[model samples]
Target: MPQTIPKKKVRKPQKVGKAQKGKEEKMQPMPVYEKEKIPFRLRDKVAIITGGDSGIGRAIAIAFAKEGADVVICYEKDDVDAKITASEIEKNGRKYLLIGGDVSRENHCQKIIDRTIKTFGKIDVLINNAAVQTPQDELKKISAQQLTRTFEVNIFSQFYMSKAVEKYLKKGSSIINTTSVTAYRGSGHLLDYSATKGAILAFTRSLSSYFSEKGIRVNAVSPGPIWTPLIPTTFDAEEVATFGSNVPMKRAGQPVEVAYAYVFLASDDAAYITGQVIHPNGGEIVNG
Candidate 1:
């Protein structure tokens, strides 16, 4: 009888202790919404911000309001969050209109424009900021539905919103799309999200050229890891704990830090600028 060969013993990876896990979870960064001594640069302008209910969008809306612009906030759901943002706008003595709808629909985009026009009379700035992301470890793990939804929300809505508001935008008007650092550097897990952001960067550049003759400026903001609601919800606890740690800054940015870029692009301060992108990405240098 042949002697049975003994299989080599393999050790499983050790699990993190509960105490260490708690310490990691506590490392998550907090989000900041406001800054001191912000100048009123966007005075008398009317702006529309998609996903204005929370995170970076909320910070932008409040920052614009502080800069003396009346804002129209477009959000999908979350009436409570919308109300909170509205309260902040009101605190700054700026008027705010909250319109809830799915921007992925062309018709809804039209309605956003229509409602803003009807209420605010004209649109001076359009911030295409709504986006969704699903992280997959591998390409095969990404589903068709996830890919479609990510594109629809992230890139398609920009096209729809821009088209819907194009005719209304006048000379000196600005359209700012929210891209991401991943658009420049790419993301291993956030494949679909990164692709949509890349598309937005291309769209912003092309649209700027098309609108150049019309005197409407188009630009984009590419942000790195920022402390926002999307962080905790989309990423696992371990990922969230280490979020933004890889950046040169070694910390996640505050929403208000990124909001300043939108304020700059939306104001006449950027009148000579178009087809450009601003990076608020924790000192991550990216070409193009």
Candidate 2:
């Protein structure tokens, strides 16, 4: 009878999947999903959003559409993602125009504005939100070409876009630039990117003052670590996984959360707000 006793089997511990951990711990998904509940504040307005194919750009495009604004989306590539944004805009009963090209080129920026005017007659809002960032641990690792390219796409594009839309923008029209939290705090790995963002903040302030007499408002939105395509594209897997863990909120901000800031800046609600920056960086306090 004693010899007939069999050894008991033990169960091994199982590893948790990233996706499973995300769900089980109620972690925010890559792109936070949300629907607009605000009233139609931007009814009949015409807006242009660069990089509108995905990420924060897509969220802002959708938010603008829901607020009753006709949207002109300028994207470099990814027709699939652009189409998705277009469909969502159309679903909101708003007119959508998709322009595919590099916004960093001055000619392309002009063409974008020209097309928007041709389609919508006037530009009410211009969002210079297209940007790129390449992480390098050491300054020496950043080549001259890479640095130049970053500036072109990040800051130079904003200049070109602003100039292109300036003549078309009427009084009370808004210009919102997407800066970054790194502008204030700085990033060792993102030196060039942070520098450009700092320039954007200065541009926002100076542009706001320059346009004040003309009744046009210029502002910027500085987002901390928002879950967007940029994170996965720029950071490694480990970095991406722990992206917003260092922030005060201990979580990445959703595009939807940042989208509202753009909406408010574009609407009459921010009539007196210009040359200012909106911090949506998950409770990270910074001198703005």
lDDT of 2: 0.92
- Residue pairs in steric clash, candidate 2? none
List candidate 2 stretches off by more than 4 Å: 1-38
Q: Estimate each model's TM-score.
A: 0.86, 0.86
Q: What is the lDDT of residue 115 in candidate 1?
A: 91
List the pairs of residues colliding in candidate 1: none
Model 1 misplacement above 4 A: 1-39
Candidate 2 on 1-288: residue-level lDDT in tens?
457767766666455566667564544333434546557989999999998889999999999999999999889977899999999999999999999999889999999988888887899999999999999988899999999999999999999999988888789899999999999999999999999999999999999999997899999999999999899998999998898999888999999999999999999888889999999998999986
Error of 2 at 230 (Å): 0.9
Top-scoring candidate (lDDT) = 1
lDDT of candidate 1 over 1-288, digit per residue (tens) = 999999876876545655656564533342343445436799889999999999999999999999999999999987899999999999999999999999999999999999999998999999999999988999999999999999999999999999999989999899999999999999999999999999999999999999998899999999999999999999999999999999999999999999989999998678789999999988999999
